[model samples]
Target: MPNSPSAKKALRKSQKRRLVNRSNRSALRTNLKKARVAVEGQPSEAADDVKTAMRHLDISAGRGLIHKNKAARLKSRLAKKLNAALTES
Candidate 1:
């Protein structure tokens, strides 16, 4: 419980931010999953999926929702997988 008025307002703002961040993170995960699936199931569409996922990651990182290094690592891993799949096909 927040004792001061300012504290209460801060708590309220944090709750709202939490909800928004959760939604954004969920969408990011969904996009990553789609990219992974496309990599494994359809090489032709993998590039576009990867692009979408990377864009989302960049946006999330820019907004401070995710770390920039984390986003870069994820992008690297996904690109590696995509390349491997493409080469194998």
Candidate 2:
């Protein structure tokens, strides 16, 4: 339905960007899951897992795969979990 060449190219670029963003989001979810599980099971590694999750979140936010506020909220939650783990230990 793109009448102009620029419109066609834009559509193609958007599609490609969407696919890449989806993959990045999936990866971010995976990393977050890993961090949560690590914190739940092995409290000692929670800090490191949290750091890794934060890095992934920052990357996703930078790429526009997720909102910056959402990313910050996730990071905050992870840090809270880490703190709880520390307190429990």
Candidate 3:
């Protein structure tokens, strides 16, 4: 229970922000899953999947949902997988 007016307002804002953040996080996960599926189904599409994953990673990092270094590392791993698939093919 927020007794103060400002606290009530903050609570309301927090709820809204939570909803938005949840959607963004869900979207990020969805994109990652799509990329993984694409890579598994068609190795040739790994490059494109990596591109999409990297774009989503950048967006997540820019919005402060994920750390820049974490984003970079994820992108690096995805890129590496993509490159390996390409080389193997």
Which candidate number maximizes TM-score?
1
Tell me the whole-model lDDT of each prediction, alpha carbons only.
0.97, 0.91, 0.85
lDDT of 2 by residue, 1-89 (tens): 89999999999999999898888888889999999999999989677878999999998889878899999999999999988988999
lDDT of 1 by residue, 1-89 (tens): 99999999999999999999999999999999999999999987789999999999999999999999999999999999999999999
**Per-residue lDDT for 59 in model 2?**
88
The C-alpha stretches of model 2 lying farther than 4 A from their native spots are: none
Question: What lDDT is obtained when candidate 3 is compared to the true structure?
Answer: 0.85
**What lDDT score goes with residue 28 in model 3?**
87
Model 2 poorest ten-residue lDDT run: 43-52
How high is each candidate's TM-score?
Answer: 0.97, 0.93, 0.91
RMSD after CA superposition, every candidate: 0.6, 1.0, 1.1
How far off is residue 55 in model 2, in Å? Answer: 0.5
Q: Highest lDDT among the candidates is held by which one?
A: 1
Model 1 misplaced regions, further than 4 Å: none
Clashes of 1: 0
